[model samples]
Target: MSFRLTELAEADLECIAAYTAKQWGEAQALTYTGQLTHAFRKLGGTPSMPGSRKRDDLAEGCRILAVEKHLIVYRHHAGLTEILRILHQRMDLLLQRLF
Candidate 1:
């Protein structure tokens, strides 16, 4: 499977990387970004695996995961593809819609 990150998601990821660089360090920021990227890839690699996540909705074709206090929301589209959203775990996710 492959993945396509929405523009908003890409921008948010850049913001996250910048924040991590300031709060932690460039090295740590890269690590965090890498980890998140890898996680998203894994999520796309096996559609069945994502459904195991708590609160997942296979019917909705989406799943959520917690990564370093942030919530990663992702949806699998047809053709073994996925889209990702990195958000504050405490936020009202619906308000973050970009599509």
Candidate 2:
């Protein structure tokens, strides 16, 4: 399966990189972003694998994967994985109105 990030997810990643870089450093930001990228690829290849939680409550076929302090919200369908959002663990997901 192939994966793509929604505009919101892309924006979230950009914000994450900027925040991480400001609080830590450029190297740490790169490292964290790399980890997120790796996770996206892994999930795209094996979206239903263990360690990812089913989130049908949010949407049909929805799934959530936690990496570090971030939560990746996605769905796999028609041989494609669509990343819906990348939110901080502390964020209130319901308030975000995640699709």
Worst 10 residues of 2 by lDDT: 90-99
lDDT of model 2, residue 33: 98
Best by lDDT: 2
Candidate 1 clashing pairs?
Answer: none
Deviation from native of the Cα of residue 77 in model 2, angstroms: 0.5
Q: Would you estimate the TM-scores of all the predictions?
A: 0.80, 0.95
Candidate 1 residue lDDT tens string, 18-96:
9999999999999999988887777677644633353343235566777776777777767554555788778876666
Deviation in angstroms for 61 in model 2? Answer: 1.4
Compared with the true structure, all predictions reach lDDT values of 0.72, 0.92
lDDT (C-alpha) at residue 3 in model 1: 71
lDDT of 1 at 21: 100
User: Residue-pair clashes per candidate, as listed?
Assistant: 0, 0
Q: Rate residue 63 of model 2 by lDDT.
A: 94
- Model 2: per-residue Cα lDDT over 1-98, one tens digit each: 58999999999999999999999999999999999999999999999878999988777788999999999999998899899999999998767866
